[model samples]
Structure formats: structure tokens, C-alpha cells
Target chain A: MNHALVSLACHAYVVAALVYLVYLVRQMDALATGGRVLVGTGLALHAVALVGLFGAQGGRPVGVAQGFSTFAFLLLTIFLVVDVCYRKPVIGAFITPLAVAVLMPGLLLDPGHVMSPDVQRPLLPVHITIALLGVAASAVATGVAVMYLLMERQVKGKRFGLLFSRLPSLEFLDTLNRRLAVLGFIALSVTLVTGAFFSSAAPGFFWTWTSKQIATLVAWAVFAALVGARSFGGWRGRRVALLTMTGFCLLLVSFLSSYDFIHVGGGAH
Target chain B: MEFLCIGLSHRTAPLGVRERLALPEARQVELLQRLAQSPNEAFLVSTCNRVELYMAAPDMNRVRESAREELQQLGGPDALEHLYEHRGEDALVHLFRVAASLDSMVLGEAQILGQVKEAFEKGQGVGAVRGELTRVCAAAFGCAKRVRTETAIGRAATSMASAAVSLASKVFDGLKDKTVLLVGAGEMAELAARHLKQAGATKLLVANRTLARAEALAAEVGATARPYEELFTLLTAADVVVCSTASPVPIFTKENVGAVGKARKHRTLFMVDLAVPRDIAPEVGELDWVHAYDVDDIQKFVAENAAARAEEAQKAGVLVAQEVARFVRDRAVRNGVPVLAQLRQRGESIARAEVERTLAAIGDGLTDKQRKSVEAMARAIVNKLLHEPTARLRSVGPEHEGNRLAGAAAELFGLEEAAPPTGAGGPNVVANGGKG
Candidate 1:
């Protein structure tokens, strides 16, 4: 039943993403409302599914399917909250589809997977939560950067097509990108700190400096520079958007490299 | 009652004819009042581009003749050449299109809808709008509102000044935070300055070679005047620059823009060059700080405006058609009203005559109480017999079946007066309404 909820939510997110893409090309109130309402419904269903999984697992999600489901949930929650606040559901064209892709592994694959009991350290969940939060924020910023570039091109090139008119102002996208980058940076800083403590305290887990960790460090530096340059140096426009996009690519590399698969019923404890 | 629309638009007439036919406030009230006598309800929408009068009545011939007379009197000899008229559903559709701006000179413009609303309000005040015109206008306004919201019909503004402001908005988030610098006091510059001001540019500066002329233009537009010598300084402070000077050579150079780029932290700048020889150098546009569009480029945008919104406009047109269809179908029920009224009148009179004869045959045995009861029973029998026909005509039918049934009932009842005017109910547009 919980998987059914996840499946339903996934379908809703897919449809919402498509509607938002159409809206990006040709804006209309009905399309925006469709996208918003579907995202809202999917988020509600996904939240309930997550709570059900928590009850079944005694608190945290149990397997790889549950883990990625939780990650996709974080993505949708962050996206919907910020979109509602900023009134920019157009960016959902990028974010909701990514959420659907992330949720697909959990929905399509056989459900059971497990890892070492030590990998389930209580502190690790906190780190995962903060890190996923950072990832979602950075992903949203990346989407906004893409929008900024598209608008900047049309304004510079002077095409003035439907896409040009449908897009929000370049400055608005740039401002939103900067704010999201800073927010991601703050969340990521806490994530790195919490992850370090988890690594040091958990048994059989050590600071090995894996490729994922290196990429995380690199992404963190890029975002720090972005937030720092924007705040102290008053940097804006294309440069900021470019840097945020770069950071997002690095973060993607870290997420994919670090995404470990477990043997089905690997037997915890 | 059938709806009618007659007059001249920019499509059918030139500016001279439109201007000659345009009605002022006083003239509009007088015209509406004159046209709105008992049986006819009228509305007049008089703008610079079009002067159209909408009316509804059962007797369309008399109304059309009066409308032609008014047109001839108001527009003189040219009114006959450019006149077109729409009747019945066609007139209602035309109103829907006009209110949605689909029939505007510049398709999807925002002003026509407001002008239509203003005319409607004036008609309401003049007491010239009743059943049919009121229902049709209300639907027109609703369809306009939906077209505006459900489609991007009004997103593209199609004038040079409006294009500049719209492009500026694409770069900057809003004009309220940006400063606009006008480099000349020409008509184009003055026009763009007013547009920018209307678009909510709080800080506007005018700089021209003739500072006095600049000051006068600035005063007229509620802006500050600056010396042309401080042009580069103004450029540094301003985010949008409009150059309309008559300079033979380029007034600005790439080197000057490159130098000013650092002063403003390379903030995005938009410049519109409206001069004949081009006020700003074309090379200045190559610099990273600015995007400059000359007169041709702006005009190109103007020409592309309608084509760009073609898809959305098509969507709005479909929406308007659907709304018009729904209104027509809803209004078809009213077609049966006259027939039902005639049927009730004939039946009640026949019943009264029959009841009196029967009572006379029954002789003096019938008391006053019995006579009243017999009369009441006769009226009840007529009403009961008319119920099914009335209900069928009023409801239960296909698109045009209600009206057809009503006409058939009128014929069956031998009510000659209930028939509609011949050749008048069909939708028709006559180009030669004005007889000189």
C-alpha cells in the first residue's frame, strides 16, 4: 500500500513536470494551476508513504529503495516550499522530473536491499538528511541558472519569441539562483560537519577520502566562492549563474559516485 | 429580440472617416438615448480607431434604417462606402471578438477591452441597455476576462515605445528600480519617456544638445533635464537609454561605453536608438554592458509582435467562439417567449367567450357564485392545455430546435403577429448601409 502511494506520487510528479515544461513554452494560468496542484498532491502522498515506511522500519528508511525514496521526497518538499514562496512554479519543469527519476529506482526495482548494521548509525541519518537538503537546494539553483541563461540569451540576441516572453526577468532568476546557492552552502556546511562526526564515531567507518568525498569538497568550495563573491564582492548576473551550475554538476558527480547498492537481505546485525 | 452591430472600424475605413464618425461623450449619450426608444436598446462604442453601435430589437428593419440614417448624418458622404453590419449571432460574436481584442486594429491590445467596458458602462448609465444587450455584453466581458487569463493574448505590446519598455523589463526585474535616460527631445524620445514613466520608471533624465528643449520635454513628462555634456555620466547612472537625436554621425562610441561599463559594475543596459542616422554607434552594441536596438530593429519587433502571439491568440479565439456558442444556445430559449405569450392570449380569450355563451344557455338558474367558479375553471383549463407546449418551447430541444418549435407553434396557432421579420433574423453584414 505504501509502495502504491509512492507509485501514485511518482505519476503525479511526472505529469506535473510535463505541464510545467509546456507552461515554460507558453504560459497560462490553467497550466500553472495544473502543475502546482499535481505537485502538491504528489508531495502529500509521498509524505504519507515516507511516514509509513518510518513506522515499518522503526524510524529511518530500511533499504536502498527506501533511502532513494526519502531523497526524492526531500527534493519535492524543498522544491514545492520554495516555489510557493517565490511564486516560480516554472522551475518545476526541471526539479519535478528529477524527483521522478530519483523515485524510479525505488518503484521499478525489486524492493529488498540491505547494508552493514554499522552503516545505519543514528548520526548518519542526520548527515544524509542535511546533505540531501543541500543537494535539493543546489539542484533548484541549477534549474534557476538554466532559466537565467535562456533569458539572458534572448535579451542579448533580441529574438523575442514565445519562450522569451514566458520567461521571468533575467534579474529575478539571477537573484533566486544566488539565494538558493547560499542556502545550499549553509546546509552543506552542516552536512560536512555531521558527516565527519559520523565517520569518526561509527565502527569500521573511517576517513578514506573517497572520490565522492573529494567531489563534495570541490563542490563545497565552488559554492562557497559563489556565495562569498555574491555577498562580499556584489557579483551578479551570468557569472554567478555559471558558477552555481558548475557546483551543481560537481554535486551530481558526488551523489552518483557515492550512491552504493546493497545486496538483497544483506542481514543487518 | 435580435442583436445588431453596425459601423466602421479601422479595418473598413481610414483615419479621416473614423475621426469624422467618432462620437464624444455628449454625442454618445444623445445617440444612445435617441436609438433606445421603446422596442430598441442601443450601445455605442466610440474610440479613435472605431465607432460601432450595437442595438437589439424585434423589428430589425426599422432599427437598421435608423442606424443608417444616424451613420449618414454623423459620418457624411464617406459613411456609405465603408459601412459593415452584423446581425443575430454574428453581431454577438463580433462583440465577443471586439471585447477580447481579437477584432482590434492591433490584435490583442489591452485598451480596446477597457474602452469597450467604458462604453458599456456609459450605455448602462444612459439606460439604453436591457435584456438582450445586457446579456450579450456581460458574456462579452466574461469571455474577454477568460481570454486575458487563460491565454497570453495581451502579453505582447506592439508599439515602438511599448516594445522598448517591454524589452527593458526582460533585462531588469522591474522599471521602478531602474533609471531611464532620454538622449534627445524628439517626438520619439518624448513618446518613449512617457511610456517609461507610465511603466513606473521612478527616475527619468532627459539630456539633449539644446538643454532648454530638453528641460521643456522633461517638464512635460515629469522628468529632470540634464546637459548633453553629462551624457556619459547619465549613461553611467542609467540602466536604460533611449537615443532619438538627429545627429548625422554616431553620438556614442564603443570606447566610451567600455569605460562606463566598469563604473556600473557591468550592470545590464538596454538602449534604443531611434535616430535617422543612428544616435549610438552600432559598435557600442557589441560591448558586454549594453544591448542596443536601432529604429529598424525596434520596428522589426513591432512587426513580429502579432506573429509571435499567433498561437496564443488562436487559443483565445477558440475560447471566445466556445463562449459565444454557449450564449447563443442559452439565448435560443427566449425565442419561444413571443409564441407562448400569443398562445396564452388567444386561449384565454377563446375560453372567456365560450364560458359566457355556455352560462347564457344555462339561463338565470346560475348564481353569481357559480358564474365566478365557471369562469375560473375555464381559465384553468386553458392554462393546463398550454403547459406542455410552453415547457417544450422554453426548454427541451436541440441547438436551434427551440426557436424552430416556437415558430411552428406560432403558425399552428394561426397567430400571424407572432412571426419574426422576414429575411431579418438571419445573420447579415451589409457593406452599403450608408446611403449618401
Candidate 2:
């Protein structure tokens, strides 16, 4: 039943994404409202599925699938919050499709254990939650950054097509990107601190100079530079957008590396 | 009765001739009063581009001659040569075309509908628009509204002021929080400022060479007037700047705007240079964050938009034709209403008289309940008798066939000599006057 619910939620997200895509093309108010409602419903059902999975696992995600589902839920929650606050429906043309893409893996794949029972410290859930939240925030920032670049090109080229008309101004997209990046940076900072504590507590894991650790550190440095440059260096527009996208790509690499390392490292326990 | 529209439009008359025939508010009221004295319902529309009078009268030649006389008095013998007359169905079609803006100088401009409505209201105020004219004007208004919504006639911005607003909206998210700087309080600059203000720009700064003229325009537009020397300072704070000075040279150079860009932190600045001599330097547009559009650019956009709207105007023309047809049919059906009422009244009165006579002959032989049933039966019989003729009368066409059928029905039912109700002449008036 829980698996079925996850599948159903994934389907809802896909439909919502498709509706928003149509809205981007047509720019109709009815389609926008329908997309928002579908996304909201999908989020609610996704939360229920995650809660059921956690309850079955004794109040924690058991494996990669559950971990990915939790991340997708948090990502959608953050996006909806921002969408509601800003009332920028055009951003849904980017974020909703990204949400569907992110949730597909967890919906289709079996969630094999990544950490043995013996190595599961109490801080593991907190570490993973903060880490996934950081990733979700970065994903949102990346989506906004891409929109900024597209809008900038349109303005500079004087294309003024449907996409140009539907998207927000370059300045507005840039501001949203900067804000999301700052938020993601702070969350990643907390995640790193908590992950260090978890590494010390867990039996097999260590904060040594492993490949995954190096990748995570590199990803952390990229975001740190992004936030710093934007705040003090007057860095903005296309340059900042490119750097943000690059940092997000690095974060993806770091996340994949950590997933592999966790599976291999779990064998020892 | 006869319907007639005698007028001169931009197509037939020069601007000088049109101006001579144009009626001011007081003069229009006087004209309507004179028309009311002649027992004809009349409406006068006198805009800068056209001067027209629409009237429904009992005599076609008399109405045309009087309308020509009125035009001759307002204008002169030269105006008489340019005046054109459309009678009956042609007159109504012309009115619908006018209201829908298909007949406007600018193919789909929106102002003419308001002008027509104002003319109608003026006629109503002086009791010159009784019933038929009221219905015709109301239908014309509906037809205009339908054309506006169903087609893209009024969708594009075809004027310089509107094109500027459209350009600004394309650049900014919205104008509600943007600041506008108006340089040189010229008429075009004031018009653009008003357009921007209507589009929701929050702050307006007016700067002119003379402080008093700037202050006057500023007060009129609810803006702040700045000194001419403070143009650069105002540019620093403005998101959109509209310049329409009568200067011989460029007012803002590339260097001046580039410096303001720095002061504004590289925020976007939209500049509209409506002056013929180009108030802002063309090179200023090449500067980062400054987008400058001179008069030629705005005019080019307006012309392009007007051409696009002309295509949509074709669709609106079709809609106006359909609406006119529907209104004619509906008017035909309404024409049958009074006659149908009189026929029913006549049948019911005869039925009641016969039933009372029969009841008296019985002399209380039947109970009160029986008598009541008998009366209801009489009413039902009368209704059954008149239903087909009533339906036939209401279903007649708007053409001569319908008129002939109505006349035959009135004569057969002995209603031809009976006086109609006070307001019952409305449909007859339109039918007679609207038929060629």
C-alpha cells in the first residue's frame, strides 16, 4: 500500500509538471491554478507515503529509496513555500518538472539498506535530513539560476517570445536565486557539522579523507564561494547564475559519490 | 416612420469642414431640443473626425431635408456637398458599424463607442430618444462590446502612448512600483505620463525649462516638479524616463546615462524620447542598462501594431454583421407583442361576456363551484383559439412580409382603428423608419 501511494504521488507530480508545462506555453490562469492544486495534492500524498515508510522502519528511512523520497518531499515543500510567498507561478514551469524528475528514482527502485543496523546512530536521521534539505535548496537555486540566464538572453537578444513574456524579469530571478543559494549554504553548513558528529558516533564511518568526503568538501566550497561572492563582491547576473549552476552540478556529483560510499562502507558493519 | 443618418466623416469631409459641423455640448442639447419639437427622435454625434445625426421620423424626405438644413446652418454650402445620407436598414447598419469602430478613422479605436454612448445619453436627456432610438442604441452598445471581446480588435496598442506602456511592461515585471521621470512638459510628454500613470507607475517627476509650466502639468498629473538642472539627479532615481523637449540637440549623452547607471547600481532604465530632434542621444541606448526609444521607434511600433489589429478588425466586422442580423430578428419578434396582447384581450373579453350570459340564463341552477369551472374552461378555450395566430404573428420576418402579416392581423381582428397603448408605437416606429 505504501509503495502504491508512492507511485500514485509520483504520477500526480508528473501530471502537475505536465500541466505547468502547458501553462508555460498557453499562459492561462486556469491551467496555472490546476497545476498548483495538483502539485499541492501530490505533496500531501508524498508526505503521507514518507510517514508510512518511516513508521514501518521504526521512525527512520531504511535505505536509499526512502532517503530519496524524503529528499523529494522536502524539495517540493521548500518550492511550494517559495511559490506561495512570491506568487510567481512561472517558476512552477521549472520547479514542478524538476520535482518529478527527482522523485522518479525513489518511486521505481527498491530501497536496499545503505547502513547496517549496528552503525545506525541516533544522529543519522538528523544528519541526513539537514543534508537532503541543503540539496533541495540548492536544486531550487539552480532552477532559478537557469531561468535567470534564459531571461537575460531574451532581454539581450530582444527575442520577446512566449517564454520571454512568461518568465519574470532578470533582476527578479537573480534575486530569488541569490536568496535560495544563501539558504542552501546555511543548511549545508549545519549538515556538515551534524555529519561530522554522526561520523564519530557511528562504528565504521570516519571523517577521514575518503573520496566521498573530498567530493562533499569540494561541493561545500563551491556554494560557500557563491554565497560569499554574491554578498560582498557585487557579483550578479549571468556570472553568478553560471557559478550557481556549476555548484549544483558539483553537489550532484558529491551526492552520488556519498551514495556509493555509504553502500560499500555499510558492508563492513 | 423613416430612419435616416445624414453625416460627414473623415472619408467624405476635410478636417476644416468636419470642425465646422462639430457640435459642442450646449449646441448639441439645442439641436436635440429642436429635433424633439419636430416629433422625430434624433441623436447627434460630433467628434473631431465625424459629425453625424441619426433620426427616426414619419417622413423620410422631410427628415433628410431638415438634417441637411441643420448641417448647412452649422457649416456652409461647402459642407452640403460632402454630406452623405443612409436611410432605413442602411442607417442602422451604419450606426452598428460606428459603435463597433469598424467605421472609425483608426480601424479599431475604442473612443468612438464612448462617444456614441454619450451622444445617446444626451439625446435621452432631452427626450429626443424615446423608445425605438433607445433600443437601437442599446443594441449598438451590446454589439460593440461583443466585438471588443470576441475579436482582437482592441487588443494591441496602436497609439504612441500605449506602445510606450507596452514596451515598459515587456521590460519590467510590473509598473506599480516603478518611478517615472517626465522631461519637458510638452503635450506628448504629458500624454505619455498619463498613460504610464494609468498603467500603475507610482511616482512621477516632471521637469521642464520653465518651473511654472512644469508645476502646472505636475499638479494636473499628481506628480512632483523638479528643476531642469536636476534632470540628471532625477534620472538616477527613475526606472523609466520620458523626454519630449523642444531642444535642438540631445539632452542626455552616453556619459551622463552611464554615470547614472552606476548611481542606480546598474538597474534597468527605460527611456522614451518622443521629441522630434531626439532628446536622448542615440548612443545612450548602447550603454548597459539603458534602453532608449526615440519618436521614430515608437511610431514604427504603433504602425506595426495597427497593421496587426487591422487583421483582427476584419473578424470584428463579421461579428458586427451577425449582431445586426440577430437584432433585426429580435426586433421583428418584439413587434408582434402589442398586437398579440390586444388579440388575447379581445378574445378573453368576448369569452367572458358569453359565459356570463349563459350563467345568468341558468339562474343559479348550477352551484358556485360549477360556475367557476365554467369560467376557467372559457379562458382555456380562448387561449387555445388565439395560440396559432399569436405564434404566426411573432414569427414573421423583419421584411415586408412581417409588416403585411401584422397589418392583415390588425384589420381582421378589428384592431386597426383601436388606439394603441402609449408605448406600443416603438416597434412600428423602428419598422417603418428602418425599412427602405
Best candidate (score: lDDT)? 1
User: Candidate 1, residues A1-269: lDDT per residue as tens digits?
Assistant: 88899999999999998998898877788888899899899989988988877765545655557666777888788888877887876778778888888889868766645433444467665676677778878888887888888888887787777667778888789888888898899988998888788777866666777877888889999999999998777688888888998998898787656555446333231
lDDT of 2 at B145: 95
Q: What value does the lDDT take at residue B257 in candidate 2?
A: 86
Q: Write the per-residue lDDT of candidate 1 for residues B1-436, one digit (tens) a residue.
A: 6678998876787655765776657888998999987557889987655789998876677888998899989889878789999987788888999999887645676767877988888988988876557778898999999998888777764345677787778877888988899998976777788789888998999999999999999999999999999999999999899987766567888888889888887887889876555678878888865888875566455556667677887898899889987776565565556667778989999999999899999999988999999999999999899989988878835455665676577678876555442222321111111111
lDDT of 2 by residue, A1-269 (tens): 87788888888888888988898888888887888788788888888878876765456665556666777788888888987888878888899888878888777665544444454467766766777788888898999999987877665555556676688876678788889888888888887888788787766776788765676677788889988887776567777788888877777766655554446323221
Write candidate 2's Cα lDDT for B1-436 as tens digits: 4678889987787655765675557888888787655457899987655789998776567667777888898888899999998888788889999998887655666767887998899888888888778888899999999988888776653335666777677667678888899999966667787889889987999999999989999998899999999988998889899887767568899988898776777777888876645678888888757777764555444554466577787888888878777776666566556677878889999999999999999998999899999999999999998989887887776454455566567778877654433452433522453356
DockQ for all candidate structures vs. native = 0.37, 0.11
Clash totals for all candidate models: 0, 3
Give the range where candidate 1 chain A is weakest over 10 consecutive residues by summed lDDT: A260-269
lDDT of 1 at B321: 83
DockQ of 2: 0.11
Native-contact recovery for every candidate? 0.59, 0.16
> What TM-score does chain B alone reach in each candidate, compared with the true chain B?
0.61, 0.63
Model 1's alpha-carbon lDDT is: 0.78
